[model samples]
Target: MDIFKELQERGLIYQHTNEEALRKRLDSGPMTLYCGFDPTADSLHIGSLLPILVLKRFQLAGHIPIALVGGGTGLIGDPSGKAAERILNPQEVVEQWASKIKDQLGHFLDFETKESPAIIANNYDWLGSLQVIEFLRDIGKNFPLGAMLAKDAVEARMSKGISYTEFSYMILQSYDYLKLNEVYGCEMQVGGSDQWGNITAGIDLIRRTSGDQVKEMYGLTMPLVTKSDGVKFGKTESGTVWLNAEKTSPYKFYQFWMNTDDQDVIRFLKYFTFLSLDEIAVLAEGVEKEPEKRKAQRTLAVEVTKLVHGQEALERAEKISSALFGGGLTNLTSAELEEGFSDVPSATIESPEIGLVDLLIKGEVVTSKRLAREAIENGAIYINDIRYTDVETSVSQLERLDGKYLVIRRGKKNYYLIKFK
Candidate 1:
């Protein structure tokens, strides 16, 4: 299938300008396409996945992918979907964020390919050197004030109020496209639905600047991902799911997808995974025939986790997940325990030997010694997946998995971690 058709099948093509011409251009030969990511945070979140994956798809199809880091634009945040002005980050902070984001983007694209190697560019290199008079005379003159105000980004923020710094973001992004086109011969730009205004503005800038020289420039965007339950996708009660493992652990990231709603699983499979359409069709059937199996959700979780965090991390995450479900914890390593119980109720004790009731009470796993004793007698307390019915039974260092950690279960679901210092 053509690259465009493949993207269409995956439900990735939200909006594009001049589809027929773009298709013809892509069909003719390799075209350089760029997607800009502003470093608003130290790590990119799940919200940024679609654009990154889109760039990957294009690269796999023999097109040059340019991952543009918005070092300059990061200083002046884009107000595309914001209700209020963004707190500007220091120049040093933005540069640091840009460097980290550039490294993360490297994982998604094949930079070492001899043919059509991926390119990483920073807008700060050029934008920083630009003078106010030069910007006004060259780039600013091309964008009409009426059209700028009419854009959804500006219109939405008009009532709430937007600063000149943010309002000028579109022009900066447009200039980025012009610069990329001039330097790399980039013919296309892609982003999420929220960036439709900015993407189109770039296309307009390219046309106006190059006139007859640049006959066709393309813009494409992906849909704003949202859940069937009406909540935003890529978000949990805790916060956004970050690509950085330190920010959001591999286990939690895997669990996020593993818990995908049945209603949204098949769609997410198509959107997120590189699995063939036929393979996804089989999973879709599994979703309808046996929702209890959760095969689709599991596959989605495994594939996405591996893509973001590597194969070893996925294996560890899977093992940790299984261990949490009473699958057994005899083989769990200390590092796995640390990751698995990172967010669970935890306490530290100097000595490894302690009575079950005392440990429970001290760790705040149970409110009182009396309650801990009652829980033990009632067969509701377990130590390392083994039932502990004796309140006076003492946990020893020998019982600790990996000789350092203990996993205590208060009931069927509530678990606590005890660390032996």
Candidate 2:
């Protein structure tokens, strides 16, 4: 398979140093390639998912991939896409975050595969030890002041007064490429479009330093994932959609994709999923014919959620999601209950046994016990989505989900969670 062509067809390739050279190199044989991710956050978001998947695509196509975690540069902070300087974190905190990033990257790439085992390189291993004098004498000398100032990343920040620390980021990233090339024989670097400047800097550094040994080092970048509205992807009203289920529950993760706009879902499938172009073409037809059924959106959600969170978590998410609308809440675990109804109105009680009218009042389902009784008499009150018509009965008579909670549906849409502490 022509991995280069596949990436291009999927619209994953934003820019490349030399398409002809890169394609010819990819066709000749497997070459080592690397992509860097800084430990800017504790968990990787949907934005990082694209390049990580692209790296896996290369690995599946029999190329060596190096997942470079920027423990070194992370401390310095890359200013390529930022509007202002970043507040530096302590060295220990950055190391801890880098360790977490390494774990997340492991889920997608196959390090155990014998043919071309993926390598995880920490720039800290080399960058952490280099003396400032040695860095200036060796790496710094190769980067021309004019060239550094001309990079779009640096140029844009120059008028706003770019700091020396951020201005030096390009050279630091360039040294990473030079080091990886010498150590791993890595010939290519891939990143988001924002890193175009840093990526090219690295390629040039490799050429200048390696001299005759320079064997066609290349750089490629994927488009910065964006919404149809042109806002950046991976954020919601709640915050970043994190890969860690603890940070963003699996149910929420599933919903994030399930909620992809009609205009964005098809393109997202191509960018995020391993589904073949032919299969995606069929989905596109479905989208054109029946946007109401949302088949394409569901497929994209299922494919991506399963890829990231596995079948079991995917099943849990689907179960809770369906139950919320279809009245199957009994099958869910306590943790699932919390995740499913996290945004719903909740009231806590000291005991599970409570008068139905009083419970409804306590749960804030109704303004008063009289209103609660009225709702019950009218058969508008539901316990765990089952209509409860008896105003005299107590909540203890109705089954408590997981022995501790009652899901009260006041009417067709409003839901209130009553928790027994």
Candidate 2 collision pairs: none
Best by TM-score: 1
lDDT of all predictions, in order shown? 0.91, 0.89
lDDT of 2 at 305: 91
lDDT for model 2 comes to 0.89
Backbone atom clashes (below 3 Å) for every candidate: 0, 0
Q: Where is model 2 more than 4 Å wrong at Cα? A: 159-161, 212-214, 343-345, 352-382, 387-397, 410-414
| TM-score, cand. 1 vs. native | 0.96
lDDT of 1 by residue, 1-421 (tens): 3899999998988999888998999999999999999999999999999899999999999999999999999999999999999999899999999999999999999999999899999999999999999889988999999999999999999999999999999999999999999899998999999899998999898889886675588999999888999888988877889999999999999999998999999889988999999999999999999999999999999999999999999999999999887567878998889888887889998985678788998788889888988998999987888887877787763388898788888877888988888
- Worst 10-residue lDDT window for candidate 2 reads 206-215
Q: List, residue by residue over 163-252, the lDDT tens digit for candidate 2.
A: 899899899899999899889899999999999999998988877877676568899999998899776688887788989888988898
The C-alpha RMSD in Å for every predicted model, in order, reads: 1.6, 2.5
TM-score of each: 0.96, 0.92
In candidate 1, the residue pairs with backbone N, CA or C atoms under 3 Å apart (3 or more residues apart, or in different chains) clash, namely none
